[model samples]
Target: MNGRSPRWTVGGPDLDLADPHFYTDPRHHGIWRAARDAHPVAWTESARTGGFWSVTTHAEGSAVLRNPQVFVSGLGMRLGADPRGVEAAAGRMLVVSDGAAHRRLRSAHQSWFNGRAVAALLPVLRRQVDARLGELLARGGPFDAVAELAEWMPTWVLFEMMDIPGPDRDELAGIMARAFDDADESAAGAAGRTAAHTEIFAYFAGLLDDRRDCPGRDIVSSLATAEAHGRPFTDDEVLLNCDGLMNGGLETTPHAVSGALLALARRPDAWRLLKQDPGLLDTAVEEVLRWTSPALHAMRTAAEDTTLGGARIRRGDRVVVWLPSCNHDERVFPDPDAFEIGRRPNPHLGFGGGPHYCVGSTLARAEVRCLLEALLRHVKSIEVTGDAPRRPSNFLRGLQRLEVELVPEAGNGRGAGADGEEDVHVHEAHEHVRATGDAAGDAA
Candidate 1:
């Protein structure tokens, strides 16, 4: 409402989202390569949200997060949106909060995701992943792995962790998806989000009360009765944490699960290799997280003036640490674009860095590993029927829908991933800029 219009920018200043070249065209790799090289920290003026400094390098990204005081997360992660959306989402408890409150809130849930803590929840994780795989097999042939693995898989896992009980798990999953879509810039989007938040919050509020009276072996119970600052968590805090867990855990894992399937589908050799040595699952999981690079960017506004990548960032200026882009930075990764299962010393920024690295990173690793083991154990091969569609957001990155042929492990090698596509293993596809100002568009 304030600006002239959503001023579109690109290597070609005339471009906008409506350009079919971006939508129909798949290889925007050139654009990303350009942004990284020509201007590691590129800026584009606003038609709407003014401008944002995109940090496409690894070292700069690390700096953005290492000093939270300088690159604050609470200013709102998705570059610029309505102030009302940010305020409406106040009390939300994920990585967005800063300082003492953030440190304290993070500690409260520390036990829930600690190595020992997550390992304890493994048995349940195994059962759920296995059951889901069987359902995938019986359902047969063509199936939306995104629906099964990405969406339902993590939902069930998080549900069990939160002690969500029976059918409400599905409700919570729907609500969480709605929460992301609720970020849409429309009254309807806001209304849907409000209702979804109210329902899930109310549901958790009641459970928190019940847990307070009769504690159980669930995370909600842990938080409801938790007392760190000489008091119980405020009602809003409790609900935000629950919703945050559901949203963060749910969207992230599914992206990896489904993205891995897509990645492996593209490389049958990798899929076949996985079949022969399931021991490689652990490495495979890390590589999957790196290759897919879900949860695209995390925001941090400068708390004070600082220098990053030779740019003077003044206090209050907004800077975004691009996660997936860093994963593909040629300087850090020999071949940043290619998905290498054997990527040694593969310290990708997929989970982020510094004190703000995904608190649930370990849990996410275990959850994804569990799902992979189950899928690899039963399913022999996977094939995609058409081009995979990515979600439309600059923040969260994952598939919207992925059609997959769940060929049985016994699949007589029929209909395998095409010729050159036979999953060869020569790693390293690094990125470079084309010396023009092209943007990879916001992939959330």
Candidate 2:
């Protein structure tokens, strides 16, 4: 306990962390700074929904996340999630389940994200990223990096891994965008979210059925054939988990990539530093994840009475761990606001901790690292031509659109991975990603 009383009262709009606008507005950074300084663990009251304990500091947020038995995720993991919907998916979904159920479910899909498994996908990932960078540079004008590059890379990798049919990929991607859309916490917004989920489930349900009779070498097939408690996963379990995996895979890395470009654009010196010393790609990617902290907050319900930061928490009280705040905690990372590429021992909770740590973290790191490598090998500089619009969602924080001019490296006719320099960095970066298993953040 910090011995300081929790900020029990919500005094103004700035303190209303539940509002999506708070995330989009630049002032939110200062707001989190103030909140963390005044009340590391504050009691927030929302009239529209309900009240929750906002865990803002790194120490307390990590403590809550690390102790899942006391703070269970089965009730809900996000602020605006519908209570009834959460109840229905409680034990079935991987993100919401706790205890033994969560372990078994995670084990079923763990093989896909292991270091060797993700390492196998590096060549394909590198090629795709390189090709995309080449195409964008050839156009020779300002382009929407979000629509063209940031969103494209992860979506492609996810679809390829899932083996979704070519024609169906576009439709599924659109539905997924809506499923995690930055909608408000209102009745209408809830309906829209539910509809998107229904569509995703229906699509995955068909895929699950197809995988049952003729299993393929993909995640869906593995889940369809996987056995837990000596029994196969039921249709509901498979469908719900598929929804969780897709949401996690698609929603996070794009924002990290977008945020990376935005961060570099704002600080050209960082980009120049990376170009000069490509070996820094490993730490640079970690810095991007820490700086972005795309998965803004994760919620958990108290399973038993507990005292957190000197505040009495009832069994049913909801506690939300603000990831960005934790990542930005001055106590943990010195000069936390500065995007220092060479930061060492960065213990950012961009990814939720404990049993619910992000399963796709390795793949996410690979994707970001590949993009940066492509940029270093081909693009000379990143210039932000227009205002980068941010996604308006309290749960997810990222740029919705980034208009940037990608200047091609001089005398480099070919796209990414064209020259020998790429090979050297790729080898080094690949070894780094495979070796550093502790890297964490975003999407759990």
Candidate 3:
């Protein structure tokens, strides 16, 4: 809440939004609450990432997102910025592009990510959810939900959508996960990051070549053949946009589901209610998105001298909008901290908003809803078996490990550890498939 510019307030209690420590601990909430109450648009100076404004309140954060013209993304939408410069080839990606370019790129893939598109994929997603959950339930107790189920859900779905082969899919997933999770700035870290990017870009470049020769029904091929703003997308634009979709598809919804599982385990009453009435999943999914707010914050550069939440913002200043704070804004939701499954009119900024809103919103909702429906229908109870380790990432609030003991419902149970007859055949089949995949991936 200091009145002094960030330059003068360097050694003060400057909020470093890019720090992974705040995300893994409880201190982030208190800091954001103070920002919301006293300095919704506070200045923060970090030696690593330089100075930026912290936009914490719901109204002001939403305002910054909606008014993309005033708060631009072209300078790079990430903290520490994009070290390679914003105008680099990959800068044309959907997350950092603005104005006409943004619209054009988004429009190219809009049809594949709309509500109808997701609805069409409902059967496929449900089967995937059931298969994964069933395998986890059969394994008995104390399972890491992230490694066993949450992480696999979106990777399978996204791979299917993009027409990536099974062997390559797992490798690419590992590469992308490492690239995003590695926020280190050391020389070795930089080299590793560059190698990952090189591998990914080279991989996609091959896909682009294939698509150019023979376009298919998949997303990448569609993008290759599609036009944006009266001309076909350049190779660089295609590569960046494809990479952007992969990152977006992989990260957000899975973490939200893991959070929801933790929430349900803590509140048995909410779990019981959802179990009784499965139709409440739509509202329940919205509440989970709000409660988790996985994509923690997004950066925007001020396009002109402006004011936000009563604080003056100068042109060229970096503004980080804290989505978690906005979702928990007291002014918007009553009992904002409580995990209310039936929360209505939850206008959360979890998937962001306005022109740059996540195009994967529809798919994310469908994926989360499928998981909830599967959990409600199959499991009788979910108890926390051990400590749930949170992933250390400033931008992503994910669970690294969530050990849960799941009790299956009557008649549907089929395992020695559970209260039913053992299904050795199904368990062995799942293991075989898993082993095969692991071997193939290792060989690659």
Model 1 worst lDDT run, 10 consecutive residues? 425-434
Best by lDDT: 2
Who is ahead in TM-score, 1 or 3?
A: 3
Compared with the true structure, what per-residue lDDT tens digits does model 2 show for residues 1-444? 323246544337445677777677887788778878788887787665578889889999999999998999999999978788899988888898998888778777676777776876788678768877877888789999998988888888778667788799889999999888855666787778789999999999899999999986677887898887788898999899889888888899999999999999899999899989988999998999999999999999999989998788888889999999899999999999899998998888987788788988888889889989888889888999999978988889898899999888898745753444544444454444334422332334
lDDT of 2 at 270: 95
Which regions of candidate 2 fall more than 4 Å away from where they truly are? Answer: 1-5, 8-15, 184-186, 416-444
How high a TM-score does candidate 2 get? 0.91
Model 1 RMSD, rounded to 1 decimal = 10.9
Best candidate per TM-score, number? 2
Residue 228 in model 2: lDDT: 71
- For model 1 the local lDDT of residue 7 reads 22
Model 3 stretches with alpha carbons more than 4 Å out: 1-15, 89-91, 183-185, 414-444
Candidate 3 lDDT by residue in tens digits, 1-444:
445342222224554566766577766777677667776777877666777887788999999999988998888887864557466842478888888877777777776776555665666567667766777777777888877778888887777767787679779988987777745667787678678777888999999999899976667887888876799988988888777888898878789888989999999999989988887888999999999999988899999998887678888888999899999999998889899888988999998877878888877888888888888767899999999877877788878789888899886654222222223332333333323321211100
Give candidate 2's error at residue 196 in angstroms: 1.5
RMSD of 2: 5.0
Question: Residue 10 in candidate 3 has what lDDT?
Answer: 24
- Which TM-score value belongs to model 3? 0.89
